[model samples]
Target chain A: MNNAVLLQSVRFIVLVLLQVTLLNTINLSQYINPYLYILFIITFPISDKDNRLLFIFLSFLLGLSVDLFSDSGGAHAAASVLIGYLRKPYMRFSFGVSYQQQGQKIAQSPFSQRLIYISLMILTHHLTLFFIESFSFANMMYVIQKTLLSSILTLVLILFSISMFKKKQ
Target chain B: MRQIIIFIVRNKNFLLFLLLFCFSLGITIHSHIFHRSTFINSANFISGGVYGTVTNISDYFSLKTYNNRLIDENIRLREELLKNGISEIDSTVTSSTDSTTNYVLHRAEVYKNSYKAPKNYLLINKGSHQGIKEDMGVITSGGIIGIVENTSANYAVVQSVLNTNSQINASLKNTNHFGTLSWNEKKDYRKVQLTDIPKQANIKIGDTIITGGMSSIFPKGILVGTVEKFTFNQSGNAYIIDVKLNNDMTNVGYVYIIENKDKNEIEQLLETTENE
Candidate 1:
């Protein structure tokens, strides 16, 4: 239990630092900006012992930290909290009955299930973030374009990182 | 009371989510609608310090290009000096004392720059300590960059010209047909739109656009852009012209902050007149 807490804390700090310092500065193009920090929320432990309230708060802080560096107001915090609250239901839908078991290990989950779960999280996060940032329906096309392209880029980075850091049994 | 407590316990998660979400939305709305609270931005100490340190390292790599730009600017200024026959040094000094035009320029380095966002901003290393303040104009050797929106002790945020919220006074090179300069809904850093020019202004593609100096923020006749394209609005009374900006906003590394000594006086006069 102590180890789990330490791991999550370390992940939080590392991801936020990587995001604000490195990923935020990489302007691949006007349409695509990969937010790899969302990986912290996506890979957070899902055991029954986990405190959901604490998770939501941590997610808000994570996004707020990014917002501070990016000058994005609170759009990131809102998106992250929304996803943080929805993560349980999303886990149930994607991971099925296994999500209800004690100490569910997401790493051991089937590949297709992980992909579905990650895609849903990234898509929801990007949609909420881009819409709120734009804050208008007049440029719906531009917002949608940005959301889709940015989500794809973020999804690829998340998946690549996951595969690269997969634990050896 | 026990039943109410149970109900509250049952819905605590939803309530917490709603509470946090509302708080965030309030911040977003507040920042989007009006001037933001200066504390919650990159200009604050920790993030500002990080950006400053990182830029200190990265700036070393771009010194050559920056040096060349400075040389080019020096040559241009010398040519202008010779043409105007000013044998003595120009009175536009950077000191606290007033010059003839009363505009003082301070040099600053861009620590962080972003052009992809709809509302983009640049963070500079200088701030209140360096005599920088909100609403002062920032320009590079190429052209205008932005206006300072906020400042901390050692850093400041400049709202870039590419932002959707930005609108500046601009006009034809030598003509008095001024209009509002702004960005289009489309995301293009290289181009901005100039609107509200009367139909009889005789505009054409490739015509030069310069700052109108109607506002105290920017002086008259600074080069802004060239006419890239032009067309009539729906009513056909004014031209909606596209301008290709002179400054490459994405490549900006250094800027000059322009402070007008008469800004407070001008604003006070306008306020008193309005109350009459």
Candidate 2:
């Protein structure tokens, strides 16, 4: 019913579609899976209407769509849901929202906290992703290599998309 | 119902989050396997569409490169068509096969190509839809590029000869000296050291390296590169010649996948002897 919630869901759907159809197919190599769709969840405002439940739900949908096209549905789910779950503690910790003021969602998240949250989530998601995809300790160096490369690329895209769409307040 | 709604509202955020999170996890675990891989597959198809759309936007500049490749390929094929009268079976190449070869030519455009990596590969625009198959040798006007690594209906990947791990038999045109062409990972020059070249054989820096055609992967005399530096390795049984590739693997745009007329037979023969 909320304007922001509806728009965010639409954005999430659009990101999932873009990620699966266009972005996923851009296999720069056997590795380097770019995760641009995380932008949807990252940009979702922390409001009463759009709470943690919506975050996880939308994240799962986006991730599942990507993983299917990506040939690893569980992979994106694990990462997306992890991002979703951690978003709460992450928001609480970095945003400096007091425990008593928990229900007060920040309409315009500060750039510093947003950067930190996005970086940690992106790092976390990519680490789990490439590790599970490579699935071998034997490929220790390569797995790490893939993780770093994909994360950097995905991070750049996430930052670009969020800044482009988010209204400055 | 009123009490339950009140309780749920009190913890709506947490409960809703958990439920959605769990639901997504359930779908994910199931979708990972082939049993429910259709979802992921559909997702891939959707992603493929999106990729196609985005490429369309950025394809303007790349179009120049793509057009240049097409022109080059067109000229080569047309010239052959004129001299061979479109029926002489490409006399530029001579085969030892007992029967007339039935070579089929397929057009493929390189989509994603990389040579910076140790094991380099290229993804082409053509796939099973364009009659591409696994192990089909891909080439360009320059020379032998690589072999098909994977294939879908719309796209396929080629294992580039520039890859460090790539091994193909080649010989010096002048002295009949032979060795393997391997990537020198340290340099962008793509100097392939022709190993096992008879120590006594004459090899000059300007000498040419061509496919020996000892194997079916590539035809004979397709230029691999030219000797940049020639010397005996630690083991003097061969001359380790540094070959400078003529076709820059990094700039590959348009490629012609050479389908050996007798590839199946060649494969069969090799497979039979592999056990021995």
The DockQ-derived docking category for candidate 1 is medium
Stretches off by above 4 angstroms in model 2 are A2-6, A13-35, A45-89, A96-107, A126-160, B1-60, B66-102, B111-125, B152-215, B223-251, B273-276
Over all chains combined, what TM-score does candidate 2 have? 0.61
Model 2: which residue pairs collide? A20-B47, A21-B46, A21-B47, A21-B48, A22-B47, A22-B50, A22-B51, A53-B17, A68-B40, A69-B44
Give the alpha-carbon lDDT of every model: 0.86, 0.68
Question: Which regions of candidate 1 deviate over 4 angstroms?
Answer: A102-104, B36-38, B86-100
What's the interface RMS deviation of candidate 1? 1.2
Each prediction's Cα RMSD? 2.6, 7.6
Every candidate's fraction of true contacts kept comes to 0.57, 0.41
Model 1 lDDT tens row, A19-103: 8777777867788888899899998865556568888888888889888988888889999999998898888899886667645
Give me the candidate number with maximum lDDT.
1
Chain B TM-score in each of the candidates: 0.92, 0.69
Q: Which DockQ-derived CAPRI band holds candidate 2?
A: acceptable
